[model samples]
Target: MTAELNARLEPTGERWTLVFIRELRKPPEEVWGALTDPGRLERWAPFTAERDLGTTGDTTLTMIDGDESTPLPATVRRAEPPHLLEYTWGDDLLRWELEPSGAGTLLTLRHTLPGEDGLGPMVASGWHLCLDVMERLLDGEDVRAVRGEEAKEHGWEDLRDRYAKMFAG
Candidate 1:
């Protein structure tokens, strides 16, 4: 399935926000588990979490780019199980809101970045692939994570261009 590029920008004090929404066919709890559980996250997320995200506490998120790995200090600010989750990844703030939508869940993510580095489209494209893989995994499909440079094989650059055009006008 082609993932929709449903991303928008908003002003939030000193930082900018990338508001993204995706509708999943899975229940809220299932989607919440994929977002919070380290094992489940590894299956779809681009980074690996050091601890369970269900609890509000300090954690580390390691981004593996080829053989290079960068460890970023992160903290779980709020975790309300199947409803809400707010966390900080390095200098960026990510807030997740989940609502039950019929037999599925409507997932909303607000990614706040420092200043306006013009990274909104790039982040939006990256998240589009991540959510696509997440949707496949939740649908009981065995698929490898298409991230980083590997994302080019999955039309990430095209998606990014699309987002860029949308944001520019």
Candidate 2:
């Protein structure tokens, strides 16, 4: 079978990275709080992450879907209050960097997945959706409907295109 396209931005450079940046309407501390809080994660993404909102280390994010759940074991590599948070997601290094953007906060997500065994596209899609949800959550808007619409529109072709573009760029 062929590989899937990315759900968000295409990969770039030799690093095989998927990067997404969004300016949250809220301040840095509020944005950071939302991201760190596990209860807030579920409201946006379809996962329940278990970890200390203040301390960062080895944390497990269990994806919630119906009655099933998949535990994604990860380790926090770095953490700086209301600024930066970097972690390992499977074979990829996921980094969440926040910056002051006027009265709002600019949040950038960078994911680096090594190798090219088709995992890049898969993870990109998830990040895209999660970022969308995060955006909605920051705006205090309902994200379930938005996620459903995005899934309906993109599907797998989007995933493959994302990877192909990453390879080309």
lDDT, candidates in the order shown: 0.90, 0.67
Candidate 2, which ten residues in sequence have the lowest lDDT sum? 1-10
Task: Give the clashing pairs for model 2.
Answer: 4-159, 4-160, 5-158, 5-159, 5-160, 5-161, 5-162, 6-159, 6-162
Q: Pick by TM-score: which candidate is best?
A: 1
- Displacement of residue 155 (Cα, Å) in model 1 is 0.8
| Cα-based TM-score, every candidate | 0.96, 0.73
TM-score between candidate 2 and the true structure: 0.73
Task: Please give the clash total of every predicted structure, in order.
Answer: 0, 9
**lDDT: which candidate is best?**
1
Query: Model 1 — which ten-residue stretch has the worst lDDT?
Result: 61-70
lDDT by residue for model 2 (22-134), tens: 66678889888777787777776646678754466888877665566778888887889899988776666778899999999888888787875356666655656666667
Error of 2 at 49 (Å): 0.7
Q: List the residue pairs that clash in candidate 1.
A: none
Summarize candidate 1's per-residue lDDT along 1-24 as a digit string, tens digits.
677778898888988899999999
